[model samples]
Target chain A: MAVTMHDVAQRAGVSIKTVSNVVNGYPYIRAETRERVEQAIAHLGYRVNVSARNLRTQRTGMFTLAVPELSLPYFAELADSVIQAADENGWTVLIEQTGASREREAEVLSGRRRHLTDGLIFSPLALGPDDLPLFDVDFPLVVLGERVFGAPADHVTMNNVAAARAATAHLVALGRRRIAVVGAHEGEQVGSAALRTAGYRQALEEAGIPFDPALVGEAGLWHRSTGAETMGRLLDSGVEIDAVFALNDAMALGALHALHARRIDVPGEVALIGFDDIDDVRYSVPTLSSVDPGREQIARTAVELLVERITARGEPAPFRRVVPDSRIVGRESTGDVPAGAEGRVVGIQPGGVEPVEVVGR
Target chain B: MAVTMHDVAQRAGVSIKTVSNVVNGYPYIRAETRERVEQAIAHLGYRVNVSARNLRTQRTGMFTLAVPELSLPYFAELADSVIQAADENGWTVLIEQTGASREREAEVLSGRRRHLTDGLIFSPLALGPDDLPLFDVDFPLVVLGERVFGAPADHVTMNNVAAARAATAHLVALGRRRIAVVGAHEGEQVGSAALRTAGYRQALEEAGIPFDPALVGEAGLWHRSTGAETMGRLLDSGVEIDAVFALNDAMALGALHALHARRIDVPGEVALIGFDDIDDVRYSVPTLSSVDPGREQIARTAVELLVERITARGEPAPFRRVVPDSRIVGRESTGDVPAGAEGRVVGIQPGGVEPVEVVGR
Candidate 1:
């Protein structure tokens, strides 16, 4: 059976012109009228193929993206890339921060606001399976982040466990038997912290090394200060560790500051590694080694998925779980040096067993 | 003549209960219906004294705040303080980011979305006098930032000129005869850049120092990298500056980085100061001195003003222009120290003129 615009108009109790207006983004339509038309379109599974409709309607030349917080450097850099990508697409992006709150996340999902945007790339932090019912929202919504499970919307995220495992493996490869993990959530069953912790254990198990409970330092917030506090506490508790893995760059920076304050030589006394290859890591004191979580790919894919959903309304595509690969960035902090280096050599103590193969020069 | 609820209901063609729902934030009412009631209330100039109405509506328990971007630390900290202040008032804050776009700013001004929250504290970066007509929005809105002029909404901003002047005067007070300015916009007549530039000139005039055009560095963006680039360019151009006043902490950081790269000694050879007392200032190598722009006060006052208007219906209270005070924070980079504090001078050189009036340690 073929679905038609007339059927949608009848179901929505709106004129065909009103439906057209809603589709075309004519701003004068009342909010309620637009909401009704959108609901009808969704109910009827009506889609206007954008590639074809674009010739007739002309491109609005706009893209919409929503994230948790911009203040977080990772997200800020991600936004910078997204804007760059959107620029390449000849589109300008409108950004919204959801603050990772449930109510706000729900509001973003509701297609009621679709009239204000062409489509949305949403990165939700607080929404999960219990809120899956809200995925029926009428607009194109591409979800990002690891907080939600079985999300009805298309999603893009990083390979959290694999990446964490690889990061920990890198430390183990450096012959560091005692590695401390920062930014561990004490009791969370899900989320990035838990997955990363699992990956840490996997790496340790694979290496035939014992995972010490005391090596896991808990940081409630992933801020730099939290990282420093966690490190300080670990030191205060007389925990001896050769390397530290901070869950994120900010925490890693805090750890670096704490180590510096205590005059602990990086890559000699303690090797420091951080996740999230944030821009500042390139210029930090002993340039941090980190995992590039493919943030750029996530942003680009999220946008593409949202656009597809917006253009293919009736076609119910299966939810997507995109796991972009991660790579370890070797730097001074991880004792990576190229031939003919111009700086002083920070000697490491002998008798520390080296594991796996070292790739860095 | 006294305006009554009956008159408002008669004009709006809605039941008194509907009006009550609109006033009380009963979410079930359709957005359009709520708008009509609000319009009627505004047209009738009815004022709902919040303190008086608090007895009836026990839920003055939430407020909405909108800023341009949360990724910027300044706005992030501002939002944090605003949330804290609202919490102190027994209220939760709902935050939204406009990405500092004019269209989004206009959308916030239009009362179309007022039903979602009781009042709005809007920080506009893109809106200006040309958009003043939109300021006639019916709901309570308190505007934050220096971009918009003559807006009917209440405004909260820093004393940019005075603060910048004071910052410049501090450099002069330290016997820096040739001071440079970073983060200057080339030809802007308004905005923070222009205001701060004016203050710089005022300080030079008072100090009897000739303003050197070559000493002013223009940056494409206010980011740290841009500040560094601008500083590098100024140095390359052979401008002999004994001091620097960066417009913001970001630019100041860039300047610090640039100075470090050039092997220029801070405080001893060239003193440095910055605006916006951002948290990062405390962590910089030579710890930056900056002006505290009273952002927390601005956020709190903006919320208070919006709440006042929200409860007041459409009584048209006089627009408020809140100018938050700024104070100088003296730090290592400024070469100012407390009396009787003698320490081993490692990298710091002697014979630098000291500025006594700086407040920071």
Candidate 2:
């Protein structure tokens, strides 16, 4: 009832081996032969069960990178970096957007896409400490970002706590005594928001300044508009602050917008700093000062770790966490820094995770 | 000898059908049965060739959307739109970034990805007329953008030339002459750049203004930095212009940056307009006026056309082109307009492509 490879070979007047090669996507096959085989396959309505074939071959030559959303500047640029790294390793990346839902994040672990790729590179935003067990799945996975901790998989991340502290310290060094923090998640016990907030408080304590809860701005989303909205509230509240530290660059840009609307001068009246040195920061009106978390290095390390896991698939390998070196990329948004600030590593101390030999830029 | 599903079924101590369903990712399987089958699959090291299985089933329930880059807000937003469209139709999108390379675009068509999906939605950048015939392939393809012309496939595009004409004419009607156009390609005879330039010229002819070649700014890449770089050159060249019509939003924002650097009064000294009406334009200082090219409509049409092609895969379907209606969105950057400018449908006339019924928004 069904057409087979033998029928296709007979229809094309080619050998079974040639038909198999054509169906398998062997690039070196002659064009004429390939076309004839393709025609026969089409004529016969022959199908290639890719899943079955991949099971036999034991290699799909494809990997997947799942993130919250590609529209976000950080994630979009990170996806591009991941693609570059995947290309270097002779693999293609299948991207999936999880909308930052815990359920959806869990689905990605056991979803059909899991069976489609050789391995996965994930940056979870919604999954929590309770969902850590989901990381113990059969597939080779390498975690990314600061959302998940103690997962039984290789992790590639940056020093979020240290970086955030150094970012706050930069503002202190710029002679700003009253620094307001934007994008603080209320009651956040984990994730980047919590870690970065803790780091900010640590810097304040070290500088002999008391941490003021009223100065911490709340943002449900780290988007530019949210940043602007939160900053607007802070400004309207009559908060006495000479400087602002946004959790991310998008918010910093948004805060700049709010400041611009209010006729406030940047680095003249109030200085602003952000994390994640996205490309937009470089081109911003008064280029944004940000914590460069070594995104490229993280991308490269994630891909490489996934490759190693895929290679050593059956063996029991120790779970390792990698924290790439990070620094602040000072720009005009922060007043004139002393010369030779370029390539200046910000945080000298390590937080919880031991340094796996920081790959300095 | 190779292990088989029958062997996996025996080892898992389940019915062959249960093992088959588990391996095929049918969701109705019991957890105990699934775990047993997974263990058997792992012990046996089974590989499910995805291509072969997809061929046998004659449907992968997946499609791919290829664009130049996702980091570009236009493409990134466009990708988000396509993903939304695909999701509504019960399909997943595999995004491929070609970096606008002709070679990369070709590779997507003939590469392994072709075998992994049922259809493709392609927005080719670096490809040309010579490569049009390559669209005549075995699979279903719906082309997006105004890059390639006369391709014998379902084409979903916007009225680039007409939209550009209306944008330019809007500036002309505002009593602004010597309007410079940013993001012009040097020798492009096809694609959006050339068509948009032609539209700008038509508007100039109607306005009794001579087209100035010196006012055409050259940009190899339609990026903010490139836009800024080109605008900087134009300013340094001492080209006196009262307004600017950047080809896209990113370039418009870049031009805005360049103007801000020069401390030039926006709208008061020089009005600026752009196309694409991306989200950033709304938040831009002295917000941007842009041609709303119906990106959401374009995305919906492309995905729907792709579905139609994929559904009618065996038969020869007549090539169809869908051009959605577009209009200009006035904002702060273009300064004030006379009364009744808000609802103006910028491009009312149709070009060579017969207007398919516009799916009303």
Candidate 3:
């Protein structure tokens, strides 16, 4: 026989309403009464029917987090952070792997699976600023990444351009001339590739160095293999380079692998830096220099924004555009530093909203 | 006005039954009629109420994938593979990060969230064979990993013992007599730690080498930092070792980092091999040697088993246990190999059901 709230209430010697309140996590109930109700429920093996509660509340207590791919360390870490933040808010996360397909990204925004989730936290890779019309859906949505700027939804991003500039400027301070940049999406006018490349150019201009198109390596995907292939091509092309800046840590790691295979000493022959200070950077041989893009802040802010939109009772607030602060983190990949010593900040960028540091992991 | 099935049917010039057939993906509908119905659905902006449909069908078309953590490269790659496989079966996956907590793992098995998912694919860490009774739940469950063996549920695993022995024997064949094993759990009787340790001892016994307790480094968590700390402790303890066998690649990478910090030349002062041939192994400075544990096969098999259980209508089949084949993959971490040369199989284990190869990435 199935156990019911009535059975629990009878066993606990409480009213059915009291049992309901306890099950719903009402905080005002007496501690002794709540304990008795909880004990009765456990003794009776009473399980809450989440679907029934969701139907009554019109909220599934679940939200979707759509990402490009979890195999990528950056996205995997971002998803992990988002799941942790969402768990604190009493929500389960359903993951959707869009594989960076434009059609699939559009399907996610179309509310095709709206019946299964209260809202969505999307990190798009394929759908760009041109797809702003799709963001006008009747659902709580928080967009991540620089793909769709000025979309009709709350957005959480990082200081991509400034961070990239800091990374490039650091290499310039090291007296690196003929610097090469990996993971350039040819002719891209938006997204991380475009913004980071723009920052690279800005840093070069400030250093009185002319931007050389030959030093830009085109990589379709920001994967380790692509990074390695791009670096290998640049080396094979006989282009004299003193430093390399990979767009992400994965690509930078790949570039390191390529350089090692060619017997090119990192920091001695060609210094290197990567974006996204992922955990992998610390374990890389000559621990990688990278940019801390404030991934945890981005995730927490995105979840908070989506939660506000989902639980709003009256008129919706104006959409917000949030950009978390980012900073450079140097290691042996860029220049030799003492073990366990925090890398000295060679150049600091102003206008950051938060204090940042280059702590050695 | 909200568009309904009637409106879609009217616009498609078809009966409501035919429209429902098209929406439900019934295969018997004519191609032209299905196209017309889909076009009508798109034009009318009609969406399926998955929750109401779930109530009628008693199936949510969703499943839960519970892992210890997604930040770990092994679990992240496994989750990516599982999501791809589940998507092919037309199901969505809700992830539960147990954080290796016994209470949380037990709660998942207790059917607390059963109402939201049709089945579960759980990779438990804390709970073990002693908690076999917990697996006797009224849900379609498929377990992964070596934690809870012989539990009353479908299981998919790898050749832990044989694979570990192969890894250890490979190090021994490299003339490394005093090999130190990392990631050992003190006094563990089950799980990967114990099973892999058993294999290490077996290899030593076969080689007529005595097992020394001093060379075993204990790590509670199979994380990179833990691996590094364990290795640092082992090195600091004045233990003479020529080889290291880390239980996992993350740990092996960490151990490599520790070795580098001390200026120990890989394949010179020490040889190392790790389990789980993760993508990181290839990018590691020395290109770590590792065991390929057939992760993709395990994921596909687990998903297929759970799907079968969920869709079963008649008498249930006996629960099955699956152990995929594993092979050792060598790289520069063990010894120098020509670039792009397939890793030579120094010693081969005969029990692998499937033919395996040593391919260089």
Docking class of 1: incorrect
| Fnat by candidate, in order | 0.06, 0.34, 0.55
| DockQ of structure 1 | 0.07
If the candidates were sorted by their DockQ against the true structure, best first, what order would they fall in?
3, 2, 1
The number of the candidate with the highest TM-score is 3
Lowest-lDDT window of 10 residues in candidate 2 chain A?
A: A352-361
- Report model 2's TM-score to 2 decimal places: 0.79
**Candidate 3 ranges with C-alpha deviation above 4 Å:** A1-58, A339-361, B1-60, B339-361
Compose the digit string of candidate 2's lDDT tens values, residues B1-361: 5676657777998755566578767787789889999999999987664555556366778888888888888898888899889988988787888878777788776534566677889999988777764565556788888877677678888888888999999899889998999999979898889988898999999999999998999898898889888887888899898999999988998888788777787778888999887766665666678988888988998888899877763334567788887778777677753321222344443433453321211
Alpha-carbon error at A269 in model 2, in Å? 2.8
Local error of candidate 1 at residue A61 (angstroms): 11
Candidate 3: residue A224 Cα off by (Å) = 1.0
Positional deviation of residue B173's Cα in model 3 after best superposition, in angstroms:
0.4
User: Could you list the iRMS of every candidate?
Assistant: 10.8, 5.0, 2.9
Report the lDDT of model 3 for residue B104. Answer: 77
Q: By lDDT, highest first, what's the ranking?
A: 3, 2, 1
How well does candidate 1 score on lDDT at residue A264?
82
Candidate 2: misplaced stretches above 4 Å? A1-50, A53-58, A313-317, A337-361, B1-58, B312-317, B337-361
Model 3, A117-181: lDDT tens digits are 78899999999867765665556888899888777678888888888988998999899988999
Query: Which model scores highest in DockQ?
Result: 3
Cα RMSD to the true fold for all candidates: 13.2, 14.6, 15.7
lDDT of 1 by residue, A186-256 (tens): 88877789988898999999999998999999998787779888987887789888999999988887887
lDDT of 1 at B292: 80
